[model samples]
Target chain A: MSSAYLAAVGEDDSRGGWRPTVDARMVRLESAVEAVLEPHRARLAGADRVTIAPDVHYPFHPSTGVVTDPAVVGAVAAWLDRELGTDLVVVGRSDDRIAFDRTASYLGYDRLAERFDAALVDLADVPTRNEYRAVDGRSVALSVPKPLVESPVIVVPSLRPTEEGTAAGAVRTLGRLVTSGADSSRASVAATQMIDPDLAVLDGTVAYGDDPVATNLLLSGSAPAVDAVATSLLGRDVDADVALSPLLSDGERPVAVENPDGVDLSGVRERLTGGRLPPSDDTHPAVSSAYRLYAAASGDAVPPQLEGR
Target chain B: MLSQFRGRLTDPKPLSIGVLGVGNIGMVHLKSALAMPGVEVLAAADAVPENRDRAERAGVDRTYDDYAALLAAEDLDAAVVALPPFLHAEAVERAAEYGIDVFVEKPLARSTEEADRMLEIAERAGIAVGVDHTLRYQPDMVGVKSAYEDGGVGHVPYASIIRLNDGPLGRPPADTAPPSWPLDPNAVGGGSLLELGVHCFDVLEWLFGELEVRDATMGRTLEIPVEDAATVLLRAPETGTTITLHCGSYQWEELPEVNTRLRLEGITGTITNRDHLPKNFYADAARAALENVASRVGGEPTVFGPTFYLRAHYDALADFCEAIRANEEPPVSGLDGRRSLALAETAYDLAAETVAEDVEVPEVRP
Candidate 1:
């Protein structure tokens, strides 16, 4: 059974709000980061180079808890630099939608990478070697990036839900990095098996539950185990998640979440249950149809935004 | 100077027009023009094929990959310059070569200097210029203006307006790739100040004549290329009203509930744009749709009638076309656009100064 460790982050700002500054947040994050990584140090100590893969899919503001906070990554890098002193690399992949460099630049990953003396790598441009793994009787192929395979990795994923209403856990974060013909869940599962990351530190410092919630918490464990814990916090069942279901099944014990700090996990779980991403700005399909019908009935010109959308 | 533009459209029965850059806003202009009486949208152009495809699906007759090629190839009375801010100057210049008038999307130009050059070209070509500063045309804003004009809010000494939206890098569940240029200072000239604040400045100036920037402050919620939020202190000397204007691209804006607030604290009572707005947007929309359908039986059509906010865009474009056909000045002239830019530039300068002032000088220990 894989047990996940949970650590509380910061107290509510007396002035009424959470996280006044990233620097101030980082100061509080360093200890929590230490607490999470302390157990994983034995696994990471042997690696010459450690790659930190974060959820850098797009340049959404960190405060919205849509993306991993750069500060959390910085604190983790600082801890590793102090404790293990391993060669560090922070990696993300650019997709057709947005460039990784652009996302990195906007989210201050460049500065964080610089301060930590870590190389920020775009996995899309990196050399890849095809790797095959079995996911539920299906042979999944992933053109796994060499850096992720070469070094022990620490995946830092934000506590949020994907547009598909599943936890955007450690598996999906890596799922986004690799090129694969398999479905997203299969790709994520294969990528996890390929990278076989040493640790995953879930940045619940801020969590997105329908909207952003400053949970002021972080959890650390193995990639799948952390995701299992995250899936539970997001009020989702592991069996429902295609990516999580396969990993958590087949005689695998349920995720054991150890909250020694006495953090209010139940309260956090309540706030985040049935949470999903905000619907796109595009007019809802039902509303659009109704509007078009209204227009046809009334002899009104269809709205430009509504026209053929 | 912009109020006195010289060119008139010789009154064609169906005003032949071309839409340049059929992106989101350009598409709105195109659709509005298509539905407009006595206006024929001949061609539309966009660099992005997806946008051109969308425009074609929206009923454009022809599409061009290059707007300049469209301007040179087609003879048009006017072109709606809805391209990116950087392209506005060049697009206008190309339209001027064909002696075509233009209705440009706002912040008119990246800077006042760029706007001056564009206006100079239009003046030399004897082509009229209109700007899409549509906030004033919104029904809620119109109601506020009507109430104020009627002196329902007597002697408003203090007024404040705030306009906010999730800019290029939109809010939450980040699904799509946001365009990079909106946050790039070199590409866009500035951030929320130009993107959103200019709209507030235009609407405020429309409400209270000739605003003067008193003091201002700008902030970035993220370490993105530009300031996502800004607050400006302004004085409308003509009305003796000191106004506070705050605009930011930081707030997550969900559709149907736009984040814009305008309030006037008068001696009699506080008047808010919110009060003027419909009590229920969906209910109001149903009413508007019903009214528009009923009107269809008797008379003229309302372009983009189903969407309440988009009516402003339709009315603004309609107003411009009307002014051009009637040989009258555009209601929102190029000078009016330039004036908004000027106010924004002043606010930026003042905000920069405040930031500099906040940086305490190190005491030299000799």
Candidate 2:
């Protein structure tokens, strides 16, 4: 059965030269996330918990030129509480300073763990970061442990793509969080999801794509589907189904749903029941599945994934 | 009939010539001028002490560290301005002011404005100003001109010239800086085209007749800021014939050969030539035909003739001297030089704009 991972970040767009509206950005993010998640809802329902990594660097609100306050975080927390129940434990990286927002902290793992009895694990504070560091003996290490591996992990990297490939944004920050959390020493995996508001919105109603920082794409309203839709609206090619292919193994394909059409959740459940289990670490190679999907969509052969133990 | 013209060959007095900037190219001209029957090198000057010492070793009796002193003392009929491009305008203007004829090197000045001023000064003084556009004097180029004028290639439609040579920096192990002219944009105007492609452009005009460049582009694909390569598209005014010229400096070998390609689609048949060396029209048709046949079979083009520069210096020098003696216009007029410079500037401007826009221009037919 396929699992759907939904991640979103809310941004404050106070600077206001040329940023998209919050709603528009949300739509784009929703489109992309839904496209990938619609086919895999059954697996998601069976998962232990859904992980969310917020934009900890720069969050702006264009309408009032204010950041996501406690009221805003409470509002989102209240919604997640109502929809996903009290089982949600939002995991974040300690290095993300922007996650320190009072509202975010209020709904953060600490507050949520007490309120809904969910565990809020900061990957940096875990022992996995040091374990991975010792194992790799390299400056840059990304990996996870077995206990955390029980729950499916969805990584949401900062969406800012640079020539050199590393930049501070929702997508990059999320990737860092996952990589840092999964390190043998810092293992805190639950399921990772990266969210950007621009991807959710279809128009230039909010901020344009610029330096991921000082922009609203990395805030709470972000989702992978929104990123794909936003990229498409800007004449860029991005497919959520293909992007999530890395999460599946050979003979086990993840289902994709195009928004504004398709069998919403009801149709997804029907497909999930009949679908086969995704290939395991033993059957599929060690290579990340997302990379395979990316290569295939780009007209290249799907190379062997990460090799087995 | 030929004997009647023999009376014109009189033993005229030798003309005194002064050699300025006794560098490599300057020395070449110096040697050639001294070898001529009615020419004498009155004085030589160079900013470098080593160059002055070398000039003295080469039998130049009067050598000076400064050019102004050399011009003052030497009773010269003509001064050869072989200095760098920046020094050309002042040196030529000063020489013309002294009522001395001047044989300045190619790219007469650093800028088109400077070249114009020099030309104006020389014309007002009634002293001839000859630029060393010696590529025209090459025997192969002469033959090419003859062939086109004689209708050997009927209805010329398109032409192209490719010149790729080892860069001036030389290769590894013997690492050297780029040639002085190209390094200093002010001295050479533009880089590869002004210093080298100027020859190709001149030859193209000579062969195809007057042509207008509908569009052109220049670029620097190397690590340097100055242009190292260029492509120009031109259309003939009379026939509306189209041509593309590609020139660059990036070959590896020391012995660089300029490649020239011409395609002429005539009413009768198409004649195409791509050769490492220049072609000659005076060769026997049977020999040319056999070479073509061998080329087809061997999958290699024929080596038609020797290059243009083999005996070009003598012919060009002779023409300049004759023009002076006969009181006639030089073979390559000043207007020709101006036109070539204008085309080069336009090509550079277009290339800059295209790069800024980051758009590729589609190849279009005239």
Candidate 3:
């Protein structure tokens, strides 16, 4: 049976809000991360070099629960540096939108790296290697970065739903690292298999439902298993997700959290389910259609922003 | 000095124009100049090659990689200084050297001191300096002003204006890396107050003359170097209106739906910009399209009306061109821009004072 563990910080009554103190929160996050990963300590200790891939697709303020809090990554790095004495790297990729180093600096990763003695590595700069992995029935090929392929990766994803209404879990986070010619869901599954991250630490300190909520919990386990639980919690049907279905096709008995005691799992589900990112596109289809019809009849130039995305 | 330029202004064939920056707003001004009847877009310059390409695509006659080179090469009546705040002074200075009048983008300079120096240079060079403060040109604002002047709402007691947009860090599926200058205090001078509130100050003064800054506050939603949000209280003595103006760069703004609110509370009722705006944008756009089509079918001059907000930008630029052609002072002159900057400086000073006072006070009871 697939198992995960949850370690929540702060009291049940203290859950309504969070203080904006990063240093204090990092202290709690370090303890919570330690607790969640305690069972898999042996697996982590055996790996010589480690890399963390966090959900930092944008430079959204961490307090908004839109990106993984740099403090969470710092806490984990601090633990690894002290306990395992492993050379650590925090990895993200640069896209056409924004450079990874700029995103890191804006989101406070530069300072966090300095404090924890870890290197912030943009995977886009690293040399890449092509690898093939079968996910579901397709032979998907992924050109993953050399650093991620060489090291034991621990995916640290924030608790949030993507624009497509699926949980932007460990799988999709890993999917962003490599270049794949396949559709998003297929690429996600292929990338996750090739990397086979040793663990996933979900930073639920502040979770994004329809808005941000201070959940202040950390959950960790095998990347796929943890993601399965995450999808279920987010009210996303596992079968509907192309990325999750292939990875969890074994029907691993409903996630049995080894230490879910004292935490209201049902309450967490109720709070975060039915959540989605804000609309991030051009004019609505109805509006666009009306404008197009008007333009055809009037010979008026269409506004560029309202034109085809 | 004025007599020397009088010959050039009247002997003008078509008013020759050059655009200094072809970024977002720069392109708008460039397109407006191109569409104008008596304006000839001679050349355009931008630091970014892509922006220069866009200007060329917009059908400009020439493109220059540097504004200084363009100013030196092009013999033009007027130039549009659409560069960032830091470059505004330098661009104007270059135009002044060429004896060319300039229409500068908002926040006329990094500070009022910079603006004063730039204006002095223009004064000695015998050139006109016009500021682009477009809020006063928007249809809804025009409607509000017309109604208030006609006493549609009797003596106004209080008023409030709010302007907000996603600032340097834009909203949503982040597509581009936002320019860094806007968030840096040194590069742009202050934040939301200068970025947006300058327009509010100009428009407010246009409605209710000469405002006195009473109290103000500034805040930041993020850890950026500059304040993203600012609120100021002012008293317009002439109109006896107590006004509250709040401008922020922290709010997410979507296209087609802007976040600018202006309301006038009077003895009888309230006058709001909402009443002037199109109730349903799509429906109104369709109506405007129909009107334009009918005008075309009838062989009548097309009004090219509606999309009223963007039309304001075109109108603002057209007014600048007309001012240059007539050799008359611009509707919004360099002094108007300086006045707005001075008011913003006052608000900043008052806000700092409030903070100092708060820190100085100690608790009496232990």
Q: Pick the candidate with the highest lDDT.
A: 1
lDDT of 2 by residue, B239-314 (tens): 6578887777644333223444455566665544432233443243234334445545443222211112422554
Per-candidate count of clashing residue pairs (backbone under 3 Å) = 1, 78, 0
* DockQ metric, candidate 3: 0.33
Per-residue C-alpha lDDT of model 2 across residues A47-85, encoded as one tens digit per residue: 455544444322222222121222222333343455445
Could you tell which candidate, 1 or 2, scores higher by TM-score? Answer: 1
Top-down DockQ ranking: 1, 3, 2
Model 3 Cα lDDT, one tens digit per residue, B1-366? 011222233444888899999887888778677766667899999989888887877679799999999999998999999999999999999999999999999999889999999999999999999999989888789889999999988999999999999887887557667887887888889999999999999999999999999999998765567888999999999999999999999777776789999999999999999999999986886677778777667532222244766667776777777778888898889999999999999999999998887565666996
Report the lDDT tens digits of candidate 1 across residue range B315-364: 88888987887767889999999999999999999988887776778999
**lDDT by residue for model 1 over A1-309, one digit each (tens)?**
778999988643454355637677788788888899998789999778999999888888888788999889989999999999998999999887889899898888888877878999999998999979999898998899999999899999999999988999999998988999999988999889888888999999889988899888999998889998899999998888888777765555677788878999899999999999988777778988998888778766777666544
lDDT of each: 0.86, 0.49, 0.83
Estimated TM-score for each candidate: 0.95, 0.47, 0.85
Best model per TM-score: 1
Best model per DockQ? 1
Worst window of 10 by summed lDDT in candidate 1 chain A: A11-20
TM-score of chain A of 3: 0.92
Instruction: For candidate 3, give the lDDT of residue A15.
Output: 47
